[model samples]
Target: MAKLIRSIVVSAPSGTGKSTICRRLLAACPDIKFSVSLTSRTPRPNEINGKDYHFISHEDFQRRIDEGEFVEWVENYGQFYGTSVKVINDALNHGKDLLLDIEPRGAKAIKKQFPDAVFVFVLPPSPDELLKRLKKRGHESEEAIKIRFSQSNSELKEVLWYDYTIFNEDLETAVFQMISIYHAEKCKTNRLCGKIDRVFKI
Candidate 1:
């Protein structure tokens, strides 16, 4: 009997430090696999293709979308982002715990297809704090920052539907909470059912 495999989808508004928390969790748990998403946007400095994202042209992205190659996809800030259906199936087939860092729209799309998957949201302590963090990035224009700030407000409302939420006031504490959530999810009845059945048969 094969045990159930689950994917964890996590999201946070930009500048909330969600990616840092995810990286820490991955470092702490080597067995978990991060699902690198496909994007039509150009890679930022230090971002590696296939590692950070599968960077592709807009035409290529739209072609895949037309072919139904993605489990979920969305266009944001004029860039396309998507998760391939193969990526999810491959990880589950190999018994890996898949982790996805995506936006609220993509996460909601995933939830429909993967009802058993755990959904988590990372949030800033306050709107003011989030704005401050966005400014500290030192790259975006003021208008860009304002747009993201508005988007964050909209995304924050989506948190109410998530399975769990973590406050990112402190990185260490947030990571601890995320890891703990992972451990707890691993022990859910749906996940353990196959093993329990096998033990009884023995």
Candidate 2:
């Protein structure tokens, strides 16, 4: 079977540990490339432009949008972020798997634009666990924590639309499950021809 590039979009609540799992998954599979979103938000102290995000000005971001350059764009937390259509097409054309840790709104947009993309929904074991994790971050103020918790119910409601739901109760276990899901996807006939050919040599 010829290599078929896969794109996976991950959606989860802010403190569900999806980012950590994604980092480990990248380390485990070097062929997979994580897509960095372009944003109008100001970069944090440690964030490097083009690495963490494109970090463009609002005017530039709007210009790109008007030019029809982005595959998916969404506004969140009073900032705009987008993924480039060109980059995603290039990655898939070369048989490289790409992953994007996108928000739910962006995930919906991407799914509409690219129906072949897989959607993974990560969830906390319980609301208490989510509260604990969010608090442990120590960066959010009490008001912000309360806001996140308030949004959790609405976010979890969207899980039903996803292809797969992963409970991030145990970090190691969840990571392995995600890896397994990707491996399983690679075997589908619609996704890969090499696997089918190898199984039946006529």
TM-score of 2: 0.89
Writing each residue's lDDT as its tens digit, candidate 1 over 1-202 gives 4344468899999999998999998999876889999999998878899998999999999999999999999988889999999988888778788999999999999999888888999999999999999999888899989999998888999999999999999889999999999988877777777788888863
Error of 1 at 179 (Å): 0.3
Model 2 lDDT vs. the true structure? 0.86
Angstrom error at residue 28, model 2: 0.9
Worst 10 residues of 2 by lDDT: 193-202
Error of model 2, residue 90, in angstroms:
2.5
For candidate 2, what's the RMSD?
2.1
In candidate 1, stretches whose alpha carbon ends up further than 4 angstroms from where it belongs are 1-5
CA shift at 163, candidate 1, in angstroms? 0.5
Pairs of residues clashing in candidate 1: none
How do the residues 84-154 of candidate 2 rate in per-residue lDDT, one tens digit apiece? 98878877777789999888888999888778888999999999999999999887699988888888778
Q: What TM-score, over all chains together, does every model reach?
A: 0.95, 0.89
